[model samples]
Target: MSLDVGAVSSSKNMGGFDESKEGAEKSGVQEVGDEKQGNVKRNMSDASMYATEDEEEDEEGNKIELGPQYTLKEQLEKDKDDESLRRWKEQLLGSVDISNVGETLEPEVKIISLSILSPDRSDIVLPIPENGKPKGLWFTLKEGCRYSLRFSFQVSNNIVSGLKYTNTVWKTGVKVDSTKEMIGTFSPQQEPYTHEMPEETTPSGFFARGSYSAKSKFLDDDNKCYLEINYTFDIRKDWAAT
Candidate 1:
């Protein structure tokens, strides 16, 4: 089933994309207004936040060590005799039906949809192309307009570690902006997770209004890419006449 969480916002920063203002949720709907405005730049830079190799260095060249991981069933069986622990597990895992899962230890994540919300405009649900190719114009952003993006996805089997989002934009082959947000880990569940990004104001000015190429990616701590999209959008002097 599709979910509607309303319009959200995001900002750009000097580092790249601004850090996420809030955490993701397994369920719920949030409506955001379009009043706030500011210069957004890439914010967070904690390389330790993502899943690294058993031994690997972050951007700062610090070594990170990861231990063994447990599958959903294995985690559920833990402390099976502890009633309190069982109850807590039930609350944390929320609606995960182990009987329906297959014999795989690796977690599976499916990105369902991405919706763009703008003030005084209908939400634009961008299609997730199967081949990761440009189907056509993804969407157009009016110069100086306020908007946010909502991502809907599902995880299954084991737990997904360090799920994150990254976006990079370019104009005339010159890199303009890049963003990275840590979406946190998630347990397998029947209900899809919905994450609404922070609000952001599109760049305004004559030079900012033009066609651009962009790539959006969803990955986990293991650096395993789930979705990679190559698409095009426009920063227009005015909203498209459609």
Candidate 2:
């Protein structure tokens, strides 16, 4: 079995080739208007509240560490009785019939870290939940500044050939727009891979202020999606206010 790993990064930059045309023609990109933006406001509100909870110090009153703080195996071992952990394990393993013992199983993929990068290539500190549950990854961006999205992950038993990314933008809880892009068709390997959104593709402009998410799907040689992950963040108009 070959281990496949895939990565995706996205941004809005001026003067890049219009890849959107080809992506649209291939039905690789899909967008929905405000009518389908329902409940986004509520979701953002919940995320904001969760961000506050994540900031609270432990009993010792020290700031909590950030980034990939724990692995699924560690969490499961720590709380074997946790129903949530069990459910997550099932999702990762997928459904398999007992009689299909000879069938090949999908490779397991683990996300190492997903974060935003400043123009200077430094990692921006965002509140990430230690247990992997979605939390508001909030950060400040100047009105017209650009930022890059970064993703890193590992695969167990397959080579990754490509990556599909879906990006959605929501403002004041309303989904303003969405886009999809394909990264590559590459050889398979096991070492960690880091993908960075092209500089010109980094998102910018005054209208970029909002809450957004990027969902990435790792694909194999057959163009079949094997592993997926999500990342959420908020673009604030002012860095000093929060």
Candidate 3:
């Protein structure tokens, strides 16, 4: 069939050239594609994509977050209320390995490092040390192996009070009671808090002073274990200079 060559040069005018319904539809499709690309750019650039797996369910619930992808350069160009900074902090704090404590046999074994961080500055290195398993960043936790913990503390007047930590580390300490126990003020009363009460709203500062703790046990085959628990935790706060 012979085709009308005039249809090919729609961008230019022809004697009988007219904007057809199909042409409008094609234009709309192009516009939509452009919009979609724009959305991607915004999402990737926003600052709420950087929460820990569990904190992702925090009360802030589903709020957009900045993540690892966002960089300092982006922050310099973002809005004052930009979430990228918070996301950046979370990215810096990162995730912890709750799978298992390494060195199962080392009773003197300080199955020591169990931490849950949010803007928390300290690294959470759960001791799941296993032999010949490609140590550090190369192990995957087994299912049901993700044992849950209370991961909490006691408080008195905005400060942590008598802190108690109990976990089935190796079945050593008393059974872990989920209820919070009021630990008297931290040693020296004037403990340094992450200190969120900043004058101006700041992105957030890592307060290594505030202490938090969790209890863990390292049970042996004979229902025996050691109790050298320590739960010194710190808080991370976000702020913006108003």
Candidate 4:
């Protein structure tokens, strides 16, 4: 018995061997099916990932409370008699005008825009719907591409403590990744705050190209949810057509 060399070469060329696919195959990973290509519909599990974890304290295992929270007016008036301290407070609070603002108002944070940045390509800015609806197919990323998210937001009324961001991703009913990032505390100011997250590389090969659903939230230490977005994106063989 003998094997046909030409047949073996033809088969190898047709299948196209690559390190990613080789590992995926050995681990029982399969290519994304057609059913997984459709847009992910909204469900009850949108905020499930960060729901419980937000209650966890910081890494030092200490929940430090700096006395009671104060309103913007109260903070400004605490040391009004001292000219030097008043100047320092004014500089630290940016250009927020506390005269018209109510005395008991709480801090408010509004997310203005979100943009996706990829090397050698134009940024894809995603619009925030008025009613917080899940905008399906917000953007597409090429497999193995490096990308990052840029966020623009405004704070008003007071200071928001321990601001943070959380993102959870899922594919085909399975949780694929989860990320938690501390954005730091923010004070009310005239200009919006812009933050760009550290870059991340998407998975490659056949099993990695497919539609994914994600839940992203911006919250603070007080458990106040500033913004929560449920969106879907695609990881394709190449960058999507603009």
Clashes of each: 15, 13, 37, 0
Q: Candidate 4 local accuracy as lDDT?
A: 0.58
Per lDDT, the best of the predicted structures is: 1
Off by over 4 Å in 3: 1-123, 126-210, 238-242
TM-score of 4: 0.68
lDDT at residue 189 of model 4 (Cα atoms): 66
TM-score of each: 0.71, 0.46, 0.18, 0.68
Candidate 1 local lDDT, 14-93, one digit each (tens): 11223333223212111122122233334445642342323221323422234555666776787999998877666656
What do the candidate models score in CA lDDT, each in turn?
0.63, 0.40, 0.22, 0.58
Model 3, position 101: C-alpha lDDT score:
19
How far residue 217's Cα lies from its native spot in candidate 3, in Å, is: 1.9
For residues 80-196, write the lDDT of model 4, one tens digit per residue: 999987776666565567775537547798988888777958998888876655556877888887777777788787777656666666666556555445555556666777766
Q: 2 or 3: which has the higher lDDT?
A: 2
Listed per candidate, the RMSD to the true structure in angstroms reads 8.2, 16.0, 29.0, 18.2
lDDT of 3: 0.22
For residues 114-226, write the lDDT of model 3, one tens digit per residue.
Answer: 33222322323344333312232321112111112212211111111112221311011212112111111121111221111101111123322122233333322122232
Q: Distance (Å) between predicted and true CA of 55, model 1?
A: 24
Better of 2 and 4 by TM-score: 4
Q: lDDT: which is higher, 3 or 4? A: 4
TM-score of 1: 0.71
Regions of model 1 farther than 4 Å from truth: 1-65, 79-88
